[model samples]
Target: MTLAASRQSIPDDIWAKMQGRSWHSDRGCLPRKNLVFVTLPYLNFSGATVEGHLIVHLDVADDVMIIFTEIHQSGKFRIEKMSLVDDYDGDDDKSMFDNNTSAYNCRLTRGGATMSSHGRGIAIDINPVQNPWVKGSETAPANGVNYNTPDKRDAAFRRGAHGIVMPDDVVVASFARKGWKWGGVFTTRKDYQHFSEDGM
Candidate 1:
């Protein structure tokens, strides 16, 4: 069923918590008028399901999950770990990446000069440990160096180490089905952890 068709609304407190970021400003980011929340099922890497929310622009609410049907049909809907952006406490990208946390932080682009799709709730960063950002010789979490390769591994480095998410991985495929762009395809820097509405 569609978000509007279901007539569901995210709870007040949960919605508040999701937007509790210090970078929420009246800048170029999408205004509150264009944002909405929808619940999405989060699956751990092990295939267990958990409750999660997907913040998105109001215009795309109905179409956002078109890919979910294909994923479910293919038995690939398992999210492999999902959480709200408010779960993390700081703006430190490296720290959050190290912990393999997924959130919707409202911060500027990596350079902090302009608003990021994340700041507008149009983008999401998944398992950072498995999908760490890469620029030149630097990786978001130093430990994620091993995942920089195009090889996607289902299991983490050690027992709990983050797994590798490759371009053709189920996660990327699901997001792609929804018309979102993966940063791993970037030519210069690879933000393997990111997916955005417009590939921003």
Candidate 2:
């Protein structure tokens, strides 16, 4: 039950992985200097503890650590898998399909060429397969479509679903305590896996 998170400057090896992927030299993305690498402990559905290496904006690094530490303390939540988006070569689709829970990417938010909180390293997505992005009839990961239907959302009070986020769950509460917005509340699209500083 002893979970931990250590935040530090991006190591040379990880920085190399992010180059041209989540970290871009030009086009004015968030600077590498403003990001911090965090090593965190999270549990998988089977109750196995996994160490997650993540990068997020320095502004949220401490908050992110505390939030996740609370989640680990609860021990009821689970994340199937997590990794840097850079490992997926910056292809968000691939990353989502793999259910790679992560934060930060060098990409614009949908609908325009604007940097999202994620692009600025201020957002995180968790358990994409269980908490998929839903818009109309389609889900981002396709696998998630079966997990988070509107009916299931109403059943959130039950809290039986494994990786799906619920209002009463530690995941939501932990993020909420930090004043971060849950994308699950979005009217346009339901991004259940998302938590961000700006609600984007």
Candidate 3:
């Protein structure tokens, strides 16, 4: 489907989860689809605020509705329980910090060397265990660079494909249609389940 159609086709449930959240255009960019990239306000483990962005593939109106639903259901629904990782300090080197140290436990990484698109608050990393970074060495790389665990090697593949896992494809597609890029497609390695606002 065309990007525009995809954006318009966001699930009602997801759309209702986004409402009243302030949007900063300077921090983000709009893509070909009806997607609007916006910065997200997040709190770090140290109680510091980190700003990031995600290229929301769904229509703003629909997402607003979804946000409302998420808020209304809050503790009652599993889908409504969105958790942010504590390691991201929202700094420009979040990727470096997250990858090099266990501080962030390799939960998330900054997109690039400078202020990453994530720093704008429009991107996200769902669950790390289910989407562990693929690295070249025996241990996870310190730079947050990752490759997808081979489906055969990854025990979560079955659960991931069956929807019992994180990094849902629909969610990824929703974001991608808006020109957001998934880290799964990284050249050196494949993240298979990572998504981002960088259209690259």
TM-score of each: 0.75, 0.93, 0.41
**lDDT tens per residue, model 3, 60-108:** 4344224323322322112211222222332323432242111111112
| Candidate 2: regions farther than 4 A off | 1-3, 153-160
Per model, how many backbone clashes are there? 3, 0, 30
How do the residues 151-189 of candidate 1 rate in per-residue lDDT, one tens digit apiece? 433344333443455657676787877788988888889
lDDT of 2 by residue, 1-200 (tens): 55578999999999998888888888688777899999888888788887897899999999999998888778888887778999899888899999889998878886577887789888999988878888888888987766667686557526666677876779999999999999888998889999998878
Summing lDDT over every window of 10 consecutive residues in candidate 3, give the lowest-scoring window. 99-108
**Each prediction's Cα lDDT score?**
0.60, 0.85, 0.35
lDDT winner: 2
**Candidate 1 off by > 4 Å:** 1-10, 18-29, 77-80, 90-95, 98-103, 151-163
Task: Kindly provide the TM-score of model 2 when superposed on the true structure, using C-alpha atoms.
Answer: 0.93
